[model samples]
Target: MTDPASPARPVAAAIRYLSIIVGCACLLLAAVCFAIACQVFIQTGVFAQSYVMVGLISAALGLLALTLSRVWK
Candidate 1:
């Protein structure tokens, strides 16, 4: 006779794997956003001359979102 808990093992494993995949995706997206923002700053030079704070804020927000999504249960 099979243990009752054995039947649910596959489902649990699938959920865990899916969650990890989603977390990685979020992180990857955030990285891309950060890279783009850096490129824009470098190309425009406007941010450097004027509002450096805004660029920093945007980067921080992207990082926060990535962290939250990854840790979400």
Candidate 2:
């Protein structure tokens, strides 16, 4: 019979990796949105409010993901 602890190891590792990936993706999206906001500012001399909003949301998501990853263990 297989050891009961064996299957859980891979699942936990997968969750940890997934959390890290998602966190990084969120941060990257935030950066992209922030870049767009900057471009809008440069071209129009006015802030693109929507871009700023999205960037904030992405940043929050990233932070949440990172937090979850760290705490999962």
Candidate 3:
């Protein structure tokens, strides 16, 4: 009943799931960075500049990874 041209469904699903996982991890990292920044700010009464910087860097890296993955595929 299967067509020869039909791709393997499981493989495609796995790839989609992997991409979602990677995206979620990136978002989680960003969230953690934000939390750290908030804590630092609350403790020191100064803007958590360094925390923000770290967050931005992490986000950029995540975005780069996602972009490359898509492009290479």
Candidate 4:
């Protein structure tokens, strides 16, 4: 029988690690995007809806990545 903690499971461990890394990156990106969006809105009297859309997308992506990281492994 194959051992659950065998070295052959490196790939699975690597994938989980990758997921955590990706989740952190996504969260960072979302924060940046949100900051940029707020800055743009504050600087420009005219509201650019696209910035909001981008920020929302980034936030969603970040949330999904984080959730995946938790669910993985």
Candidate 5:
């Protein structure tokens, strides 16, 4: 019979790589959101509260994902 632990190694690596990718994507999204929010406030003098909040949430999730990836192994 095959070793039960053999499949675990690759799975863990995949999870780590996926976590990093998601973290990067989320951070990029946060940047875009904040940029748009800034532009809107400058042009219309109206703060885009929703956009800013979304950005903040995305940033938090991204950081969490990165932390999980590092801590999982």
Candidate 6:
């Protein structure tokens, strides 16, 4: 059992909130990057693989963060 007045509790909650925020932001950024990649591909012959790679990495990280946040507590 944990104490309601513990200082660690507040810090942990803050970290969880921050993690959720970061996860959402990363997911949003990944979507934008993927959209841009598609536009770039359609306008030009280039595949824009770098943008796709970035999007994939961001998605993975975002999911991992969100999952870890839930699992932490």
| Per-model TM-score versus the true fold | 0.55, 0.87, 0.57, 0.76, 0.90, 0.92
Evaluate residue 11 in candidate 1 and report its C-alpha lDDT on the 0 to 100 scale.
68
lDDT tens string, model 4, 1-73? 8799888688777877787787778778777777777787789866767767776787788678778767765
Per-residue lDDT of 13-37 in model 2, one digit per residue for the tens? Answer: 7898899999999999999999999
**Poorly placed runs, candidate 6 (over 4 Å):** none
* TM-score leaderboard ranking: 6, 5, 2, 4, 3, 1
Model 5 TM-score, 2 decimals: 0.90
Task: Please provide, for model 5 over 1-73, each residue's C-alpha lDDT reduced to its tens digit, 9 standing for 90 to 100.
Answer: 6565798888988999999999999999999999999999999999999999999999999999999889977
List clash counts for every candidate, in order: 0, 0, 0, 0, 0, 0
**lDDT (CA) for every model shown?**
0.57, 0.92, 0.75, 0.76, 0.94, 0.90
lDDT of 3 at 1: 78
- Residue 46 in model 4: lDDT: 61
Candidate 4, which ten residues in sequence have the lowest lDDT sum?
A: 45-54
C-alpha RMSD in Å of predicted model 3 compared with the true structure: 4.6
Best candidate, TM-score-wise?
6
Candidate 3: stretches off by over 4 Å:
1-8, 57-73
Model 6: lDDT equals 0.90
**Model 2 lowest lDDT segment of ten:** 1-10
Could you tell which candidate, 1 or 2, scores higher by lDDT?
Answer: 2
Q: Estimate, for each residue in 2-71, the C-alpha lDDT of model 6 and write its tens digit.
A: 8889899888888899899989988998999899999999999799999999999999989988987897
Model 5 steric clash pairs? none
Model 5, residue 55: C-alpha shift (Å): 0.2
| Candidate 1 least-lDDT 10 residues | 46-55
Q: By the lDDT metric, which is better: model 1 or model 3?
A: 3
Query: Which residue pairs show collisions in model 3?
Result: none
Where does candidate 6 clash, by residue pair? Answer: none
